[model samples]
Every structure is written in structure tokens, then in C-alpha cells.
Target: MTEAPHNDPAEQTLRELESRVEALVQFCDRLQEENRLLRQENEQLRSERAVLSERGEQARIKVESMISRLRSMEQAS
Candidate 1:
């Protein structure tokens, strides 16, 4: 009967190191995906902010126009 080869200390250490490296690679991949999603969310929020700012400006212009009309009417009366 043939016996299986026994693991030497050096070979065992090498195997452990290889496993750690693979785990690090997976962790890096997960971080990259998370970063990509965050960038997309940030861009969407910026677009929404711009739209809201434009709407606020339009509302301010309308209010100013109404106030001017009221002042003119009061002066005439």
C-alpha cells in the first residue's frame, strides 16, 4: 500500500499565505463595488440639488413680482 506524502512545515506555511492572499483579493473587490455604488448615489444627489435650486429661484422671482404689483396698486390708491 502507498502512503500519502506528509506535509512539511514550509509547505504548510506557504499554503496559509496563499489563502490569506486570496481573502485579501476578495476584500478588495468588495470595496471597489461599494465605492462605485457610492459615486453613483453622490451624482444623483447632486442632480437633485440642482433641480431644487432652480425651482427655488423660480419661486423667488414670482413672489417678488407679486410684491411689486401690490406696492404699485397701494401707491395709486
Candidate 2:
């Protein structure tokens, strides 16, 4: 078979640079996906917090009403 062409120094450097650029592109894509997932999780947590706060308020009102009824009974007696 005919001899293969010898690789020159410039050609080798170009190949190495190209490989590094490809790795950087892949890393950027992974980071973007992670950021999107985190944003979604944050929104979900906010919604849950709002629901819990409303439920707490309802419980407080119910307890206060019961106490008022008990106080009236004690005064009547």
C-alpha cells in the first residue's frame, strides 16, 4: 500500500482545538438543562407554600371561633 501522508504540527494543533471546542459545547447544553429544571422546581415550591398558608389561616379562624363560643358559655353559667 502507498505510504500515508505525515501529519504536520499545525494540523495536529487544529485537531486538538476542535476537540476542546466540542467538549465546551456539550457542557453548555448540560448546564442549560439543569437551569430549566431548577426554575420549574422553584415555581412548584411557591405554589405549595401558598396553599399551605391558606390552610393555616383557615385553621386559625376555626380555633378562634371555638374559643369565643366557650367563653360565652362560661359567662352564661
Candidate 3:
């Protein structure tokens, strides 16, 4: 049987609506993936920052100790 061509206005409208909804769903999925990756990267960066901060503090303390030793030697001389 030959199928009739779809010429109904309501059917056309529904098809268009379905197309738009599908596009929106795909866009939302992409955004969610991007958000998840960004959060992971942010967490990694924060952890790196904490490690760097600790190293800096430790270096500062070592430098201060050396300065104190130098001052004592100078006073003895």
C-alpha cells in the first residue's frame, strides 16, 4: 500500500518539537560532562597548591635557621 504523505499541521508541529527537545537534551549532556571534568581539575589544582604551600613553608624555615647560624658565627668572630 502506498503511504500517504504527512501533511497534517499538528504532526509537523510535533515533529519539530521533538527535534528541538532532542537537541536540548544533547546539549545538556555535553554540559554535564564538561562540568564534571572541570570539577575534577579544580580538585587536583587545589591539592597541588596545598603541597606547594607546605614546601614553601619548609624552605622558609630552613632559610631562617641558616640566617640564625650565620649571625651567631659573626658575633663570635
TM-score of each: 0.86, 0.81, 0.89
Best by lDDT: 3
Give the candidates in order of TM-score, highest first: 3, 1, 2
Q: Give one digit per residue, the lDDT tens place, for model 3 in 16-58.
A: 9999999999999999999999999999999999999999999
Candidate 3 lDDT trough over 10 residues, lowest sum: 2-11
Q: Candidate 1 or 3, higher lDDT?
A: 3
Q: Compared with the true structure, what per-residue lDDT tens digits does model 1 show for residues 1-64?
A: 9654558777788889999999999999999999999999999999999999999999999999
| Candidate 2 ranges with C-alpha deviation above 4 Å | 1-6
**Candidate 2, residues 1-77: lDDT per residue as tens digits?**
96545587777788899999999999999999999999999999999999999999999999999999999999999
- The better candidate by lDDT, 1 or 2, is 1
The prediction achieving the highest TM-score against the true structure is 3
State each model's CA lDDT, in order.
0.95, 0.94, 0.96
Q: In model 3, where do residues sit more than 4 Å from their true spots?
A: 1-5
Candidate 2 lowest-lDDT run of ten: 2-11
Question: Model 3 lDDT vs. the true structure?
Answer: 0.96
